[model samples]
Target chain A: MVRRDEFVLNVELSAEPGEVIVLLGPNGAGKSTLLEVLAGVLRPDTGRISVAGVLLDDTARRLHVDKARRRVGFVVQDYLLFPHMNVVENVAFGLRARGMRREHAQSHAIAWLERMGLEGFERRKPRELSGGQAQRVALARSLIVDPRLLLLDEPLAALDAGSRPKVRAELRRHLESYPGCTIVVTHDPIEAMLLATRVVVLESGEIVQDGTPSELARHPRTEYVARLVGLNLLRGTASGTVVEVGPHAVVAVAREVSGAVYVAFPPHAVTISTDRPVGSARNVWPGRVTDVEAHGDLVRLTIDGTVPMLADVTPVAVADLGLGPGSDVWASVKASEVTVYPA
Target chain B: MTHRRPHDWRVPPVILVPALVGLGLLLLPMAGLLWRAPWARFPDLLISESVVTALRLSVMTATAATALSLLGGVPLAWILARSRLPGLTVVRGLVTVPLVLPPVIGGVALLMAFGRRGVVGSWLDQLFGVSIPFTTVAVVLAQTFVAMPFLVVAVEGALRTADHRYDDIAATLGASPWLIFRRVTLPAVAPGILAGAVLCWARALGEFGATITFAGSFPGTTRTLPLEAYVAIGAGDIDTAVVLSVLMIGISVTILIALRGRWMRAT
Candidate 1:
């Protein structure tokens, strides 16, 4: 439904109807701006935009479609509901703008509220709605227009942590039900993975990575993505298979390393030791504890030595080892567990 | 952010006393007039036909003047607040000239522009075979000339300080510029417009020098409440004058209270 001659999006986006695409980035990634350009609110500075085979913005010829004429819906970051209008009125506003009669438009608005499970709350004002409910109202308001393209800006962003999961699920269902091309913009990787069929990661206004959730999990290209996938981060120097961290700790890696190399291992693979155990695992370090943080059923121990290592342990192991800040401990890891790459 | 406001509650009594006393000073004359007003003759003064005509004329013409201001001043304020037009500062200043210019000068300016023998008045008279000065229309124009700027300035300030996101939301929701203004912008600024309208209408009702100079002090034609009160005082009819003054204040207070609730609920 969408095409452009030399769209030059840098990353190819070819989604069939009802497919949801998530654009993930850390603030100022040009995600919302891209959506605005697509919606015809902003003119593409050097490209073309089309939806459902109609030209919207063509910068070359200076042709542009007015935002009102373009059938694209946008849900902004804070769920910009018209405070002057009640929930039903806000939903009907777009339909009325499109020349629908008041009665028919309001009926359509009520139908949309029913779809979002907000039927009984029609007459309530926007400020009176809870965060999740208001978000649903904003969604219903956009969808009632029967648009060809829908753009959501951080749909679950304004939600509290406890309300996020339910709103996220509800939003996912709404996106699936909308029979149109949809794009969701978010900075949360997990939200993108759960909500979008394909996740496009943007950084500094550039698409750094774009793939399915599993693809990104398997081969994360950037340090941020690697960290997000929960890898132990380390910076050090390397010469051939031997890598030196700080002064005393030297480890062997499979890659033909030279100069600077970063070594990472999953916290699960890092084993804690109180003594030098007999093992063939090439990586071991003696260190004092710096900090301990609980993550779910495991405790992550931060130990400092020639090479600082993180050891994840269960509650039983923690009690037995008495690990805490300033506690003496030894950490060990298998050579196979460490993944090394040139910096 | 500065957490501590160093200037709070430390003012010298010398400034605050007279500042309050000045208000008391302004209100004392009205209180004295009421206290000394002839109670027995109040019925005669209140039921006088001329007084009734002037009060009704004042109420009707002030409202008409307010309507005229809203019809023209709102769009001008919106443009001043939103657009990037050249010479806008000068235009805004020009719009506010009525607030600073003497009412007599404004009356003369209006007279020159629309009077039968004046600059644009000649062509208007020739084309329409009509005269504006010394008519009810002249009364309305003169009041609007001196009062509409209040509505424009208040509304423009409100527009400038308003939450601008509603317009953006409306635009994204497929509202055209005109639709956005009509729906979002107007509702958001309605309180300010209402407040300004009340002030404009009150000022219009109380207009004296401009109405008398431009519209002339003819009986039953251009004689509004304020002009009636001025003439009664000049004719040594002090009780009738107080009655008219009280009537104007009463109407102004009623309008203010009526609009106050609208603004309160809006906010």
Candidate 2:
């Protein structure tokens, strides 16, 4: 779809039934905009949107379905629960809007809330619920309508770190049981990996990569995706098994891929040594440590050499090798650890 | 609880002096009204037929005017707050014109617009033999003409400040625009609507210049509380005028006090 003079997004990915397609992008990359377009909250300049064979919007035909009739459930990032409504009222909102009898809606809402493990929270206002409970209520509210296409924007982003894991797991279970097309938008790689059956990477309002979680982790196309997957990406010309990255420096890859190719290896795969390694490591380069940072239980050393590389070493290893800024070190990687793929 | 002193030591002379002066300035007239009031004949004056007629007329007209203002002003406020129509700023400025315009001038403007042989009134007269001036309908129209701005302005501010995302969410939940308005928008801005109604009712109750100029001061028809107060004072019946003024003040204060709890609780 095109937004005149601002940005043009050309995305064409379809979600299969019961498949959770995670739209992964940084801020201002049109993830939320795409969600809005699908939910009928926004009218695309020129596009045709059909959900489950029902046309929702057709700009060329000048036919735009009303948002209220789209049969699409949209759960925004902040939940956006009505402040004046209690949990039961919020959950029953969709049914009531669809012209359900008030008593039937209330009973259905209670059943949904019970299914969400929120039986006692029926009368509690939105503000009174904790972050996890609020997220559950939002999920319940959206799911109660049994929409054909469910759109969730950063479902777990508003949650605090303490409750994020439990809520994320619960949300995944709910999504797995949903028998409709689901599109979730998020920037966190872990959330994408945990929730997405397929990941669609968006960069600058364009689709850069679309693949399964393992495929994306194995072969990332951009630096952002590479960083997100926690892999060091290097682009070089490959001739057979040897890839020439810089002058007088060639790295050997186990797989033979000719022409332009990319090699990615985990930061932990690169073992830092004070001297040149005298082992089965095929790729080794002497470089100066540019920066040092703590990554979980390991110390990540940023090395400037033939190619900028990230090498993770344990804190004990850092003390043993005296690794710090401006320190000269040899970064080595096993040929088997590097995954080479066509660019 | 410990015994309390008559005056707190923390009261600074600068603030205390002006505060007391301001209190005296406000209360001095009320004190004088009470001091010169015919207490022995107070019940007799209140029960008099003219006083009863004017009081009843004031209540009924003010209520009708408030109802009219709410019905018209709410839609206007919604348009101002939600729509991006052209010349909206100008329309909003014009809506608040009555708030700043002198009541007498507003009455004249209403006369020009709704009076017999005037603009719409001329058409109304020739077409239907209906005249608005010098009638109970005229009193209500005059009150609404001068008091609607308060309701519109208050409700507009509330609508502007209210979260519109709730409306968007409601729409996505399959609620039509009107349903969304009734269930979501109305409740969200109910306090503002209530406050505006109160202000409009109070202004209508005390309306003098507008009702007299546009509707005329006819007993049992348009001589409301403020108009009655004016007539009483002009006729040298200071006791009646004082009593009418105090009654108007008392009614307004009572209503405000009664509603304060509800508005505060909602907020």
Candidate 3:
């Protein structure tokens, strides 16, 4: 348990060796706080934290290990590379602090930096490097220490949009090569999906959902997760092939689920028409166009009606339908497209 | 697009006139000192035994005082800047009392605390037969008492402004607090410490009231350059006094120039 201000975070978390778990959450969701606790920078009020079977913190017994001895490497959001030290000196800091010879530490740090594709930049200061370069140096600094557990908070959030994808891929490769369990915190769903072997969704200081990327994409448990995965989710009571969601009935491919359940379908699966859609579709509702946004090649239209939903149509289709905010429209989804799962 | 030239900017006479007057007021004394200096016997007077001894003593004690201040002031500054303890504002105000307190009053306070028959001084005398007044040690103590506040204030400001996240980063990198302070905090705040030390040294070199009261002026013992100049003036040796004043002005100008950027911004 950790109480900061009026926010209280009580979570029980564990990771196996070689598992890359991404803590996915929005800002102020206690993602960074969790990392700080794991790194021993902030002691939890009451908990038992043991890394690799070595007891690091047990508030019950008043056994809290000092942060310096926790052996947990944390890469902060801003990649706080020491402004005073050169790249090599910053990377070698941990080794030097642990009593290793300066020459030995430098050689080791150089090897690590070279592996990170940062050769000949040893003499450069942090300010001299680009955002991506500084991030790599921060990573090398933490990884060279060979910590038992690694925590990265928004590892690629500092990069420019053009460089984020490249750095994210490179970070993924580095995380895979590390032998220890790694927990990455990020608000970007795409980043979480790309990096995490398992994703834990946190909201309001609680874990709302924990599953693999595909599992979450297929059956998101909450509206936040559904929105993050670009799906329309509706909670309702289900019986056989139909679920009564809000004021509208959604038909799904035959499933054995009953009682409280969630109905989900991709935005692409939703079709919109200026007039009522006529098809074999089992679910249809008339709604006014609430919002229209250009999403890559498709224009996503948010329709508000008996069953509020989002539909993705091409720009040409949007032109034909004359879709804009306040335009009356009908949204339909085929029974096969709707997925039903227990709430 | 056209750009404004540097000369396009102007300072209004309302502000510029008095600013110039203030500058002139400050420079007039140095000009008078230089004009009245004994250039003819300057070499003879500069190398005199008393002048040399006093100069040596001033430099030695000022440096010793600066060093002592650094030893105790840095940690005190860290606590003042970072500690979350209650009443720290009061403690910080108390630490700066010496900066505003008259040096003679500070000298009297020091006498009450460390002089023979004084609080700590009486105990030391009873146990070890040690006496501090009228000695070189007393001169250093008095100088440190008056000058250390400068170092502490400067360092505390620097620490307060420095990025504290770096300490957390160092800790996560497996650095003990002592190691972090030695390798990271110390290096990061070095410029502040250097500037503070310079100020402390300058103040100590000019210290007179506290030294004269707490440590009596004795040639070759505690009679620093300032005391020597005072003695010269008391004996009506106007030429020697002028020479000493010119020397001090030269030293002060050199320090001001060396620390112009940091000192100006600090003030």
Q: Which candidate ranks first by TM-score, i.e. highest?
A: 3
Question: lDDT for each of the candidates?
Answer: 0.84, 0.90, 0.91
Badly placed stretches (over 4 Å) of model 1 are: A1-16, A233-264, A271-278, A283-332, A338-343, B1-16, B117-119, B261-267
Per-residue accuracy of model 3 over B161-235 as CA lDDT, tens digit each: 888889988998889889999888888788899889999999999999999999999999999999999999999
lDDT of 3: 0.91
DockQ of each: 0.58, 0.70, 0.76
Instruction: Point out where model 2 deviates above 4 Å.
Output: A2-10, A120-124, A246-250, A276-280, B1-27
Which CAPRI tier for candidate 3? medium
Clashing pairs in 2: none
lDDT of 1 by residue, A112-220 (tens): 8888889789999999999999999888888887888899988888989998999888888888888998999998888988998877787665687878887666556
All candidates' TM-scores? 0.83, 0.93, 0.94
Model 1 per-residue lDDT tens digits across residues B1-267: 658876687778999998889999988987877787787887788889999899788888999999999999999899999888999999998999899999988899989999999888888999999889999999999999999999999899989998776777677678888889999999989888988988999999999888998999988889999899989999998889888887776776788788877768866
Model 2 lDDT tens row, A80-149: 8988899999999999988999999999999999999999999999999988899889888888988889
Scored against the true structure, residue B53 in model 3 reaches a CA lDDT of 95
User: Which model is ahead, 1 or 2, in terms of lDDT?
Assistant: 2
Best to worst by lDDT, what's the order? 3, 2, 1
Best by DockQ: 3
